[model samples]
Target: MAERLIPRQALEYIKNKKLRPAFSYKDVWNEEHAAAFTVAKTMQIDVLSDIKKAVEKAIENGTTFEQFKKELKPALMQKGWWGNKEMSDPLTGETVTAQLGSDRRLKTIYSTNLRSAYQKGQYDRTMESDLHPYLMYRIGPSLRHREQHLRWNNLIRPKDDPIWNSIFPPNGYGCKCYTVAVTEARKQKYERDGVPAYNPDTRKTVRLPVQTEAPKPSYRSYFNERKGTLERIPEGITPGFNWNQGQSGRTIPVLQECLKKAQNEMPEAVDSVIRTLQNSTIYRDQLSDFVDQAYKHKIDGKANYKNTAPVGFLDKKLTEFLKTEGIETSGRNLIVLEERLILNGKYSGRHTDDGNAPIQQDWKNLMDYLADSPVYWDSRQKKKNLLFLKKITESRYLKIAVDVLSTERYLKLPKVDTMYYLNIATENEIGISEYNEIMKLKKIR
Candidate 1:
């Protein structure tokens, strides 16, 4: 039997020149949520081919559809059976990338709706409508990822990290990972019941709820094993050695040691110190102490201090350096901003966080020490590179496509196979009422 290509119904996909069947796998294989499609009458044949496989698997198990449902409920705990219904791609032997919890009748109904749209040119936009089209497009693959990660995706330990050492090795490289696609309607059904609408191929009315956002990977989770070693440093040493004005220099390598210890044990305290150092007065005081301690300057009493040139100008110089890097001015808001930036890069694409900022060599040394310690071991290194690329590409593509599709010049044509072709239809916005009116004209049952 020949393989079947289950195409999407969105006109944007059908009429898209960039999404030819030849290149459709690019969309299929990526984390990006764009669907590949084309409009034609025979496409339903493809869906039937897919259905035939599900039926065949049922028959192979010596059960009819009715019998399979009962057996499947228990058998779903088995490796091959994921949910009440078993799904697979006959061509590649890959699992179907739809939510397992969706209405089983939805696929049959959606098929009917498409048949109607093909013949009568109308149906509830909510029923196999563009809204549902995009909604399924997002959530179908989301289920795929959640399943893959929980079942298939493995964590690899870094060579230097002991905790993840046994977690498994990394992907060879260029691994194409798929994540969950989420949308409002699918969410409602999932919440009301424990099941998600896994069958995007199905078309039935399932209540929609607001989308559940995917959870983000946190720094702590990534580097949990290293947290233990990073907390030993004292606060004073983390800043650096400092001496009084015009007095004999004091030695304070212990201060540097203290800072190093706090890197893991006390990040909040570390941050506090950084902020304190940002103040010109505190920075100068600390610098003077550091210089005096290092034998670079002499600290004296108030009279000597007044007569002497300003101590430690390095603090102001360091502040300017930090600004050139991604660090923002010190404040509560900026601190939160820094945290977000450090983890996810700039909230908006236009800016980055303070991780890029230049710091005093002492600060750098302390960070390097922390990096060596277990606490900061799982800090941003490998994943940051991947995340940076993912953010840029996904944001750019979605924005561009939506901007084009919502424009008037892209008026849709009623094409075969429930697809939209670019034609002479009015380019006016297809309002919710207009969509409903079109459905009413078709007399959807």
Candidate 2:
């Protein structure tokens, strides 16, 4: 039979996984496997990379298990990683005999990695789908199955159901189980007619009514020898397999770590890192998504808004300049607080009425304005603010106000009080005078 084609989503999922070298599978741990690719006893980066590359190729080409083993066995044998070997345990710093590579190990690695990648990809696609909001658990083709898995087969639940978080497929080593998304119409049909069952005579699945309410979970205490902890894992799931891969795989905490590191570096290095981050597609996409979500929350009448995204860092020159003016920066990064943007009832309303309030598109350009525009000290206010002005045309400009004093009084860091457009052409005398005063203040870039 021709091999089934792999989904592009599945391919992308595997392609994007970060390589993590680990002495034991437990080193990487549960949902972390979704984002990090690892293999037990693979401590060397080169060996791990080799294994990951082969896996990637297998997934991309739909290579059979035998074919994968055949392609990889020679490389492993040549690299001295193919048989039982004596190696030092990184955790205990002791020499121990460990299984390195063999046919059985190769098969398990190949199957587990491929299954996880496909499952995670499917989960992401299912969550994003509006039409097919229900998920039905299906048992994979195998001679025998776990009793609990058999009981859970054909169980229908909403995509957001917490049950999937604990029980979404591949529940154990060599446990062939998966989920399929179905529409409400199909679910209704299942209710009226039946759930799907296989007809051996027709060689096709047929509808049956065997599916029922989602089963309540039963837990078992499994002592994890590697971690040396007794943990409660859902009964059907393998000790290290109880997590929603798709949900956990999407996080990018590495970016935040990088930002934190940048905060402590020299001024030039921090500025360079900030500039690179601002120009990155990932950062831009994250900022845009936050703005869109904030807008949705505002219109939806949600309160106690606490979401925030870092827009840019302060220039040290500006920090020192503020210090001279008796304003302390406290060495904190400036952020665009969601509450300040959407929940400042009257303040937001006034800007909206004046045609100066920042629209969704303006938020996208904020990082660029913060990084590249001329920053001026607003000396008129009791609590001096930093003004970032980017000229849009001859008379129109984009203005972003960063309230420095709020850091000392109410906030953890300096924040943008308001972002709006300024049109000098249409400004009243008072407004023009204020603009002139700002232009005369020291320009720190």
Candidate 3:
């Protein structure tokens, strides 16, 4: 899509999302939806791709809901996805009746995706602009409106208000409510001249008083079936739609970009970002959750087996050590690729009978091992990759091979190539020789 037709951020938000085939929409929860494009009961990859492409086109070309439904329904019908059908639920292992395609479903898909993309794009622009420091909530052009949304109408809050995280529209299904960025000068002009503000819901201009203070948010308990937890949701928001789409989409990318910029432009700020990431409870929890999900997917034989997550960054100390050895990392983070945790060929395959490979529980301790273990140079290898060995038991150790010297195409920044447990006492001749050689190399940490 051209930037002029639609906001580039909105287009990128949809275009950059990873395709995820799911049995239920709950399978991809909030914020996770920011990273993944999923349709409930759409198990086939091709069908999901077709729908996503249409959604992208709608956002790009400003297609109406009718146009989106018209262009997409025929393709879905041809693919045998029309009407209710029997589909196997991979998570529950039950054959359940699933609603696949219909006019109502298509409308929901079109509105939800397009609204989220535009809202996120608007948020990105809002964050970057200083002219508009406050956002005024305005109801959409729908004739019937939710009473709670009406109460929130004309509510003005600072851009950084925490309340926006919960009540940002689209708050519910078919919710046409939206927020417009208001400038201080314009707000002052309205107060001084008593200018009439045009209310889209009323389709009339009224002398509305400028309200800078937001209404107190009322929250209700919501049970998330997927996470099996109770969450507090604002009264006006739908259970799953409570989160701010723009903020959720911006979180990881913004942090990563900040770190990258700090590393290259402001070298002094690099350590601060890395230290904050290291100690961040949110970052650690996200890494842990990803590891758990990856392990579960692996056990379930899912296709996301090669998915990767950033575990930790190359700290200043580690970077300096690498510099002494004539290797440059550029202060990038390390990604723990799921392929490294597989117990098959290239990693503990020969010693599988002894169960020497790292299990799911061992993989969960990856962040700790990467953070605390002493790193050593592998002199036996031509690329001079770094190795991290942590004692899991008296005789067993967790080994993590980090490739730092490889080109960006093959190994972007430093990644954990292979990880497995090694038994020092009962090792084979080849294993013993390899261990002794690694132990003799110069330590980097």
lDDT agreement of model 2 with the native: 0.74
TM-score, prediction 3: 0.61
**CA-lDDT, candidates in order:** 0.25, 0.74, 0.74
Off by over 4 Å in 3: 1-5, 190-203, 252-445
- Residue 161 CA displacement from its true place in model 1, Å: 24
User: Model 2: per-residue lDDT, tens digit, 1-445?
Assistant: 1124557777777776767888877777675575578888887788888898898999889999999989888988888887888988888899989899999999899888788778877887887788998999988888788988988988888887767768987788897898888899988888888876776779998876646587777899887677675778988898899876756433333334455566656545766776676776555655665677677777887644556666776766777787898776554555554454655665368767776666777887777878888898886767667898887788777778888776433336777887777768765532455567668977887
Deviation in Å, model 2, residue 53 alpha carbon? 0.6
Root-mean-square deviation of every model: 30.2, 14.7, 10.5
After superposition, candidate 1 runs with Cα above 4 Å error = 1-148, 151-174, 180-185, 193-268, 272-445
User: What's the candidate order when arranged by decreasing lDDT?
Assistant: 2, 3, 1
User: Residue-wise lDDT of candidate 3 within 73-149, one digit each (tens)?
Assistant: 99999999889999888877889888999999998898888877877888888877999998778777777999899
Model 3 score (lDDT): 0.74
TM of each candidate vs. truth: 0.16, 0.58, 0.61
Candidate with the larger TM-score of 2 and 3 = 3
